[model samples]
Target: MLLFNTAAADVFYKQPKTCPHCQSEHYSLTNHSKILRFTILPVIPLSISYQRQCDDCGYMTPVSWYALPTLEMLSIIKYFAGVLLLGYFLIQTVLGVHQQTTNEVSYINKPKLFDTYFVHADKFTDTPKRINNLKVAQLVEFDNDNMTFRVGNYTYKYNKDIEIAMRTSMLVQDNYFSSKTMTFRKEQIQQFYEDNSIYKIMRPELYSLFGGFVMHPPKPKPLYTGVKLDKHNQEGITYFKDGLYTEALNSFTLSAEGGYSWGQLNLGQMYRDGQGTQKSLEKAAYWLNKATQQGNLKAKIELAELCLSYDCSNLNTD
Candidate 1:
């Protein structure tokens, strides 16, 4: 039993020179109305009763059957249409800005493969062992598939394995090749033997796996002392491999505080395995979930394994 009401007032008609009753020049005709509704629904027709008032005499008289002008109705329609058009444009502008921001974020996260170089051999071989050292040549191309390069006025097509290895080694050197970030599509680590520069810097022992080719040792670079999250995570991995769990935990914690996904994954693993502190499934799940939210595939796999092997009834599945 709810009651609702609305009221409005507007000029119904303009008086011609003077009021009829008072014989005054100042006069006007105005209409006032009220509408009743029940339960928020209109239950009465809209009606306007006009009144003629003489400004000089202070006299009022009732009038009837006043219709709204066609021009006034058109103006109201145009005003509403203008408001709708403005709202539509505003919505499009907001959506465009949101899409642009999304594109910018994706561009920053994806690795750019521009202006990169690779090494390939002309003689086709199943393994790096059969590749002739003299046939080794420098190549540069943009397309990931069908690598075409010219070396000494001779064009050659490089094997897919060789291309994959070169790209993987490049990303590794750039510190972006990892499970927590971007990883190589193929598991052809054996092809790394093709790159002499990478072998000399990373795996010198693998040199014997390929043809013996003399390569100049890389010059020593200045050690970095700045606080970098990736460096901290790498240091933590080194300590963990050496069984210094306390030092590894501290490094991982520092790296995780800086929002490194790899560091968060390692810290979560340490908590689950009870390496540097008491084993706590809750803490492990918390850190692992954080890493998973950042697109860490390794963290997702680890969290799934933890849930399957332990009590995770209270864990958030979402």
Candidate 2:
């Protein structure tokens, strides 16, 4: 049977009383995206997600679940592969050969499908929504015009609810202590507490189910991180574009450290070519390797080429 948990229970709530962190009701929807399974045997969803931004206290919460309830996630495909491998091994044992009769048994491969792409509907137009098995209402937030979330490897969209929640959460988180409407609403908060399901996550091992819940700060998506990186990277690009090679080198260095591999590769190329800086094949190789680890394919090829043309005594291929 499929038995895996996203720890969503610890992340979201069933009947939330108040803002878990600030104990306020001011919240808005921020963004959302969905995970798709690319299997041809059946069209299924891997996960459904709702990214909620608290309206009252500027907190973000993630709500998600297995899209396919019936399929045992771990056993769905891998289990069958293991079975095939075992069958092949058994047949080989009887034949007294370590190899297969026709071809070696290998991992069953599947074709990539376009439907495997995550389908996203964000809060930019309306509050995109879906109720969980517990009937908990979830909202999808998205940017109205961009239509893409642009998070780390994943993207989320904007929605009205998400915007509202974000606005509310920002206000609450930043100015709750100074809000003119600081009067507490105990009754409404209590009911919300009853509905929230993620309350238990605060103390998974320490607290009992009946104990009170603890609140956590919202985690910003990589998109936000990417924005910071972009700002720095853009500064470097501006410098480089204007032929301010030295300034460009410094700016690009900061951007690369901030997780922009594109910046890293650019800096390496500069070192290799002696454009703005002195010719240093070693630096080029080091930075290129770093960029490649971040999935910069061009960096990989460039590094390889550097090894063949120059004496890479300082560079370690490993």
Candidate 3:
């Protein structure tokens, strides 16, 4: 659109200069006549019986369409055609139009979803490490298979799988998490887990300010709150992924009733797919509607497509 408008402006600028005072063909129209060509495509193909002319002297003007139709007695049909073409493309955009169609829909997004993070690398997205009074938490090297890194004092132990999950997993991407440097200091990681590090680290404010660096008291699993826990939810996710339909259904059903959005999404998919649950589009739509009401954007998009597909305009999603 911008390019087209620029081309239109170019057309206007290339117009021949004409005098309106005297009834004389004063200006050099030869350059304009020879160099610039004008094309007006109107819907109805308006015929221009009279060319551009000076208002005062009634002398024929050399310029094409610069001074507006009202100023130059522009042919209505020609203007109408141009407007129709623009309107054809822009009407839906301006009018907030929607297409009602019943069809399965798929969505694709650009590949560059999340910023990449390399281990041992520091500084991710502006949050700086202020290691003023760095408190070291002596962590125990309990998990032999676990990988450890200590940024300043915070020691994180994870399998390479966990690191990969944090770095690239779609599940983590949906929930807001720190994208900044999650680098670790290995020795510090060992100390923090042992509780010896907690004893030694006296200052809390220091840890608070230098976040992502030191360890803190571990909190209870969020499982009880009904939200699906991360891999941290050891026993819960086991049967859920074993393809055991009953167990998976039970887990998701419990988790969904517990107010887990992921549970809702999966259970909705289950209904949508007719796995252990009865095949129910209505239930799919219902749970999707429920998830979206909880601020799930994916659910909203799905519901939008579903609504548009089924032509369910009478269904009040709100």
Expressed as tens digits, the lDDT of each residue in 194-229 for candidate 3 is 432222111223222123222333566765665446
Off by over 4 Å in 2: 1-228, 257-259
Task: Please state the error at residue 147 of candidate 3 in Å.
Answer: 49
User: All candidates' lDDT scores?
Assistant: 0.54, 0.46, 0.43
* Predicted structure with the largest lDDT when compared to the true one: 1
TM agreement with the true structure for every prediction: 0.28, 0.30, 0.27
Model 2 vs. true fold: TM = 0.30
lDDT of 2 by residue, 89-144 (tens): 89879675433212111100111111011122232112344441111111112222
Model 1, stretches more than 4 Å misplaced? 1-229, 313-318
Model 3 CA lDDT for position 93: 64
Which model, 1 or 3, shows the larger lDDT?
Answer: 1
lDDT value for candidate 2? 0.46
RMSD of 1: 27.7
Write down the lDDT that model 1 would get: 0.54
Separate clash counts for every candidate: 0, 53, 22
